[model samples]
Target: MLGVRLDTELEERLANVARTQGRSKSDIAREAVRRYVELHDEAFRREARRQSQRASRRDTQEDYAFWEQAEREDAAWR
Candidate 1:
C-alpha cells in the first residue's frame, strides 16, 4: 500500500486521462510505476554487465603481462 499526493494541476490532468481512458487513477498510476521500475531495472542490469566486462578485460591484460614477464625470466636463465 502506498499513498501519493499530487498538486492540483497534475491531479486534474490525471483525472482527465483517467476519465478519457475509462480507467481508475490507481490503475494508471500503478502501471506507470511498474513501467518506471522495469525501465530502471534493465538500465541497472546493463551497467552491471558493462562493468563486469571491463573488469574481465583488465584481468586478461594483467594475466598476459605476467606470463610475458615469466617467459623473459625463463629465457634469461637458459
Candidate 2:
C-alpha cells in the first residue's frame, strides 16, 4: 500500500540482483524490510529487559537496608 519512486539506475540494479538470485523484486524488498524491523525489535527488547533487572536489584537493596535499620533500632531499645 506504499508508493515509492526509484531512480532508473536503482531500478536496474534491483532487477539485476533479483534476476541473478531468482527472486521477484518485491520479494527481495519485503525480506530486506522484514530483517530491518526484526533487528530493531530485538534491540528494543534487550534494553527493556536490562531496565527491568536494574529496577529489581534496586528494590532488593532498599528492602535489605530497611530490615537492617530495624534490627539496629530493636537492639538499642533492649
Candidate with maximal lDDT: 1
RMSD over all Cα atoms, model 1: 7.4
lDDT of 2 at 64: 89
Cα TM-score per model: 0.75, 0.64
Tens-digit lDDT string for candidate 2 (11-66): 99999999999999999888888999999999999999999999877878788899
Maximum-TM-score candidate: 1
| Candidate lDDT values, in order | 0.96, 0.92
lDDT over C-alpha atoms for residue 69 of model 1? 100
Error in Å for residue 63 of model 1: 9.1
State the weakest 10-residue window (summed lDDT) of model 2.
1-10
lDDT for each residue of candidate 1 in 1-78, tens digit (9 for 90 to 100): 999999999999999999999999999999999999999999999999999999877868789899999999999999
Worst 10 residues of 1 by lDDT: 55-64
Between which residue pairs do clashes occur in model 2? none
TM-score for predicted model 1 compared with the true structure: 0.75
